[model samples]
Target: MLKIQEIRELIKLIDKSSINEFKYENDGSKIVLKKNAGTAVSYQTEEVPVQPVVNQAPPAIESAPAAEPVKASPEVQQESKAAEEDSSLHKVVSPMVGTFYAASSPDDGPFVKPGDQVSKDSIVCIIEAMKLFNEIESEVNGEIVKVLVENGQLVEYGQPLFLVKAE
Candidate 1:
């Protein structure tokens, strides 16, 4: 446990420093404090996970096409040929780091699904980031060919979220 004096000294150090967030844990007590420039500070405490750590390297993946049977459906084959000829049906990527919400709320239906048509500025879904819910708009006028992420999955910036076939 930290003494009151120690906590006060930590606050003082934070005020004098330029760091935005600080977290510390000791003797079963944990504290998280954040200071935003020109914004009020926030404080919270939560228990930390105690688990054994393992450092294992991930396997590398090949980028080229697989050397197996090149079987494709008639529609998929035509689409692939057309895709090679065109450049519009590429990808729509996420613009921020957040949980990908396919619907506005859990009980609500998905905003867009495979085979759904969309227009420019159409709200496809919501992405919750930093405690803020942001509506994601479709930048391309197209039909959704595929949804790349499951609902509520963590997504990174620039990650491909959908395959949009230009209309």
Candidate 2:
């Protein structure tokens, strides 16, 4: 088990570095910390095989140095709204932390793309971890609405790879 002071120190270190996520495991206890936008830090820990703890810090607000209100353009606002609407779709998530590949090989076409119909066993993408190529399957029958990640993007476990509209 990690002491509260030790966890605070680790959080400070992570805040000072460019690392967005960190994971530590020992003796069946595991801790995962992730940094997201808006200075919100989320953490999940499993102290025992059957018990888990999750914590999320309140979002922090920073005052603008110039005290000027910044506004997003209409196009940007529309895009953000679209993204929110797409959140209702089913997501095909990564099962492990790795580099995501859109195809089996460099020369091969992607396994699936936006608007492609996929069954429960369809291969959606490949993830390369520890020098092994792992084919990721879509466990839900649907039409792929969007490819969330680009080819060769680094993805964390449980990260959404593709959004699908269930049939």
Candidate 3:
């Protein structure tokens, strides 16, 4: 059986590589990994007997024909420009998958809000996992531009929680 850390590393490796699909079988275990444009990574595992199969060359993957680019309308162009501007801001991302908390307790005020200035060590929020509350700190010195998450939201690892304009 593969360990959790090993599976994580495999996913990272597949994400960075050109291979879109990978399959492996050993003993009574089988694993497959696949990726799509919008989907980061998807995998499946099953406990089945390994079957003996002849080694065959992989099928050639043909590239799709490219189509001419369509020009965007004026309104669409304006919205695209605005999105580009927002991309310049730094993001405070979740370090682990957990339930996000905006304050220490239900009655307490939030640790930080939009327009607040924070240093690298400032504790911006808390994340609860397995009944443990972890204080999450900002890794950058910046002024908070926006809060991306609401209180008590389920946050995924690496998901952006706040946007900031760095000093």
Candidate 4:
């Protein structure tokens, strides 16, 4: 079982992170933390078999009125066009859920950036999971065309980290 202090620390970490949900399992204990639509956060601790903390269902609320659809701005359109152009590019995706680091450390420069050339084995970024820093590599020889995630953002498994135009 996880001690209260450790659980509190985990909650605070999750609250400060961009990740919406985090699941941790140790021994026979499991902890699930999830953020709601607003600032509210819900968490639960259970054994091997996951169970709800409260058996009662929440009261239903009426749906809000539908709003008019807004048109996309010039920047949004340009980004959408760029995304379409990147379809042929090779995407470097995160192998695991973690915090993305553009550089090896705060004092160092990023391994690669947009328009930077990279070999198949070139390190592109770092992903920190469970206190372990994993150096992520570009598996294809290419020029980095775009970076998908921001530094210090939480990245999910298989989420695209960089887009490369293969040579």
Query: Which candidate tops TM-score?
Result: 4
Off by over 4 Å in 3: 1-85
TM-score, predicted candidate 3 vs. hidden true structure: 0.50
Residue 38 displacement (Å), model 3:
44
Q: What is the C-alpha RMSD of each candidate to the true structure, in Å?
A: 12.4, 17.7, 13.7, 14.6
Off by over 4 Å in 4: 1-81
TM-score of 2: 0.51
Model 2 per-residue lDDT tens digits across residues 100-161: 89999999999999889999988999999889999999988989887767787788899777
For model 3, residues 30-129, the per-residue Cα lDDT tens digits are: 6666655522433344544434333444457998774333345677556544543697788888999888899999999999998899999899999998
Question: Candidate 4 residues 1-167, lDDT tens each?
Answer: 77789878887887788987777776655667765554333444453456544433455799877443234567755774587466798889999988889998899999998899999988999999989999999999989988776788788899877888998
Q: What is the Cα-based lDDT of residue 112 in candidate 4?
A: 91
Q: Which window of ten consecutive residues has the lowest lDDT sum in model 4?
A: 38-47
Rank the candidate models, highest lDDT first. Answer: 4, 2, 3, 1
Top candidate (lDDT) = 4
Better of 2 and 4 by TM-score: 4
* Greater-TM-score candidate between 3 and 4: 4
